[model samples]
Target: MSNGTDMALISELVARERLFRARHNPEIRDCYYADATVATSWQQGPLSTFIGAESKEVDPRFVIVGSVSTPVVHLNGDKAYVELPTTTHMRMMVNGTLAELESYRRLIYRVERRDTKWKISRLTSINESDNLRPVIVGQDLHVIPQDFNGLRSSYQFLAYVRQAAGGQISQDLLGTDRPEEVERLYKETNAWLRAGV
Candidate 1:
């Protein structure tokens, strides 16, 4: 990028790719390469197929997207690494009571420039925290704090919501609940980026 404007545009590409999902834009599928993969707290598989299935399963009326900060992009010729800080604000009914859940996480992406086109080769999510609160003051969401006893506190509320929505949590996902997992993920991603992948 030769100027601030150019850098800003380049940085926005990553965030825009994610926002597309919030908007239910079909073009989001175009942001990934043919073999691209996406791993999250509840799902891991080919990104395109995941998107297609998720679109069919997830309810559109409850879709929520808060905001995404400008992504930090590291360029290395044809390979790139990106980090996007994101907040997912969602509202759902918990046992007939209205509740809100906010999941704080970072989205990491491995991008590649092929044939003059930049596409995400791999995308992974690392969760830091989750908060759940009743929408009405002095009311309960019918969920007990102890219900999260065996769950990772870093993504407890998110996991609960996923389970409530019929989604399964994967133990293999990276999260702040396990520092070693975070370290290993970074180590492997950095190595992949440095190796000119």
Candidate 2:
């Protein structure tokens, strides 16, 4: 398939993910292959568990804000491998208070062409950082963040790469030219994760 075709399929997948998060619609699973496997940083086992969390009855207001960056797609016959950067902000109300959490993830989706449609067969989420706090209205309360040492390793690797490039890394490579900004982001992410929300 052409790159354009691959990207279109990825775009559809992203849109489906946003729809699922916004509406907690179980029918959204139709976007995935029947035996799709999903691995995320926060949970183990089936992707159903993650999707089911949204279906649980709750009174507190829940919101999910997400974005998917341009994906690198490689098409091989009937299969395609897509890698993209994603950011998500999840907010919920608890005991009349509001809490928000942010996470950065590198998502890899294995897409396969079934007949004339493309379906996601496998998804692997590489958690870059978790526990980012979003500005929330009213009282400030959050969940205890989980410790992910990979954040430190990622930071160190970026720093090394920047140094190797004579202290000048392209924004395209680092996502931002400022190394301090990356450190600050990771710090905030770690704090949010430690908050456990």
Candidate 3:
């Protein structure tokens, strides 16, 4: 291929990768090469049911199936971290009706950049909830931290300190003698966290 053609292909692959990371519902089979294979050892299903199924047929249609939120994606040049919420649904073949099933799964997708395309060769999926910590305690602290912050001293301090570090906390963490550069410090800290440092 000519240099311009190769560049165009690379750009297309990058765009597809971005769209996939953004939770766009592209048919994987259509985008992936014919020889591509999604490992079945990590898949959840009857092992023999769809061994030869096309990638498009088996690929996800929805990023978040129910009340669950879409997972966050962190991407760099040739690597990405995708945290996705998997769904469980029961679809009746005879009636063609679908019902939400009582099941949940979490997945971390590791993407690799190949010569002309980006492929997901490794997927770690789990059905348990051990890793997830409650965003809020009994009283919706995530929604209203001020009302609950004062109830307990130690936890309040920790909470506010963390929030302030992220610039989400109130102004009292540093006291009346707070530094003038508090906000800038907090912003720097946030950037550091994003850099995975």
lDDT of 2 by residue, 99-195 (tens): 4556576776777777878888777665465453334644544323332222243233332222332453222222233457545644643343244
Per-residue lDDT of model 1, residues 1-197, tens digit only: 44354345446668678789778788888888879998876567887555876434334568777688878887666777888989988788876778888889998988877876677899999999989988888897778777777788788887777677777775546888899988898889888878944
- Tell me which residue pairs clash in candidate 3: 163-169
Report each candidate's C-alpha RMSD, comma-separated, in the order given: 2.4, 13.8, 16.1
Cα-lDDT of candidate 1:
0.77
Clashes of each: 0, 13, 1
TM-score of each: 0.88, 0.58, 0.34
Q: List ranges where model 2 is wrong by over 4 Å.
A: 1-3, 52-61, 92-97, 134-197
Off by over 4 Å in 1: 1-10, 54-59, 165-167
User: Candidate 2: lDDT of 114?
Assistant: 76
Q: Which ten residues in a row have the lowest lDDT in candidate 3?
A: 91-100
Error of 2 at 87 (Å): 1.1
